[model samples]
Target: MPTFTSNTAQINFQTFGDQSNPAIIFSNSLGTNYSMWQPQIEFFKSNYFIICYDTRGHGKSTAPQGPYNLELLGEDVINLLNHLEISKAIFCGISMGGITGQWLAQHYPDRFNYVIVCNTAAKIGSENTWLDRANLVREQGLLPIASTAAGRWFTDPFIQSNPTIVAKLSNDLGAGSPEGYASCCEALAKADVREDLSKIRIPVLIIAGQQDPVTTVEDGLYMQHNIPGSQLFEINASHISNLEKADDFNRAIQKFIV
Candidate 1:
């Protein structure tokens, strides 16, 4: 694993493929680290350079105080690119990560050549609802909701076939720092990009899980409708569709990027 330092926090990251190749950056979902993009990394590493980093307060990244919002988190990615001297890259983000990517595309369009957004919406849950969730995770450990969360994240077949993987991921989510999780929940709660979509001029691909309970296909359709010239692809899985339907998801992105 590699790491980088930004103004706010030190980020833990891992890279794959040749540095000279075009960069493909993948942002992980909430409560999970960059490892969530394992499937995509394996598939894309053979061609494009892949960048995976733990969002601040998740994985190995340091957890600061609460009250953080999308803009701050988005800047983390911007600073990471600046640190790497990456002038332009293709950005992909899922769930909470997708919100960050959308913000990045709107604020720093010059830094990204293309964008792939998955299982996310321009406006996430109501702020109060997310704040309540943050309070819940903070008071009680993530363990209490791990099973329910996993169920929403994966399809029934996926849960049945990949018990070990689901269990491990659940544990990982359970182990994340409560403050970090809460901060991100605030970010998600405050995120709304419906007005900003028109500003994105780069090629965009929107992927959705047909069965995703958290961010449904309707959300993908909303993005396609709003972002000019964006394409949409739906798969049969839940929130963590890319993991459950790794092959289909990776292939879709490969074709889109090429």
Candidate 2:
């Protein structure tokens, strides 16, 4: 793992495979760190240069004070690319990361060849809902949210069958920085790209989870309908579809990128 000092924060990131290979960056969801993309790293390491990073307020990345915005989150990826000296690469993100991808494709279209957003929406939840979650986490810490995260993130059968995986992600959320998480919650509160979707001219792929309660398939369809020529691929999993249906997720990526 390595660190890049962006103008606003220090970003923690890891790279795999040959740098000469075509680049592909993976952005993690909320709560989890760059490690969430382990399955993707293993699968794509041989063919693509994989870049995975912790968002400003998650993982080993430095957590700045107060509320952050989507522009800041989107810029972090751009800064990482500038540091690596890669002109353009494929961008893939899930949840919060997915929303960041939308912002990136809208604002920095020339920097990416393709953008893949998974398990996310143009507007996630109501502003009040996100603000309330931020307040709760800031006051009572991540325990309450982390405890119920599994139910929101996975289907019942997956939770029962993959207790170890579920527990690890849940526990990681519980141990995450409350301020960081809360700030990101605040970011989500104001992040809405529905109106800007039409402005994104680059090729885009939307991956939706059929069973995701957080960001439903309807949300994916909305994005597909908005973006000029975006494609949608649905998997039979929940919020964390990449983890739950690794094979299907990877296949989708391969199909789109190839």
Candidate 3:
């Protein structure tokens, strides 16, 4: 694992495949780490230089104090690119990471050839909902949230069939840094990019889980309608579509990037 010191946080990341190949960076969701992208890594490693990193405050990354914002989150990726000396690469992210992708595309259009945002929304939940979650996590810890995460993350059929994967992710969420998770909740609280979506000139692909309850297909449709020339792909899964429908997810990415 390699670490990059970006501003106030030390970002933990791993890279694989040939350096000469086209680069593609994967950002994790809110609770999970870069390892969540294992399926994507294995699928694309041969043809692409894959980059996966834990967002600040998740996985091995450092968690600084107080609430964070989208600007800080977006800047972390830019800083990581500069550190790797990568002028540009393909960006793919899910949930929280997906929102970060929007910010990156809006602010640093020159640093990416294509952007794929999955299972996310321009504004996400209302500020009150996110703030309440942050407060609850800070007060009671991640247990309550982690215990019910599977319900929100996957469809009932997927949960019943893929218990191991679900358990691993839920367990990881349970053991994550409370302060870090809370800080990100605060970031989501203020992250609203609806007004800025039309300004994004980069090529974009939006992947929405047809069964996702958290960020619904409506949310994905909103993004697709607003982002100029963006395409939308729907998968038959829930929030964590990449894990529940790995083949479909990979195929969508392959079709969009090429």
TM values, all candidates: 0.97, 0.98, 0.99
Q: List the residue pairs that clash in candidate 1.
A: none
Clashing pairs in 3: none
Clashes per candidate (backbone, < 3 Å): 0, 0, 0
Q: Can you list the residue pairs that collide in candidate 2? A: none
What global local distance difference test value does model 2 have?
0.95
The C-alpha RMSD in Å for every predicted model, in order, reads 1.1, 0.8, 0.7
lDDT of 1 by residue, 1-258 (tens): 677776567888888999899998888888999888888888899889899999998999888887788888888888888878899999999999998888888898899989888998888768899989989888996777665778878988888999988987898898888888988888888789899798788888888899998888888999899888999999988898889999999889889988
Between candidates 1 and 3, the one scoring higher on lDDT is 3
Model 2 Cα shift for residue 104 (angstroms): 0.5
Ranking by TM-score: 3, 2, 1
Q: lDDT for model 3, please.
A: 0.95
Candidate 1 local Cα displacement, residue 129, angstroms: 1.2
Residues 169-250, model 2: lDDT tens digits: 9998999989989999999999999999999999999999999999999999999999999999999999999999999999
Q: Which ten residues in a row have the lowest lDDT in candidate 2?
A: 1-10
Q: Which stretches of candidate 3 lie over 4 Å from their true place?
A: none
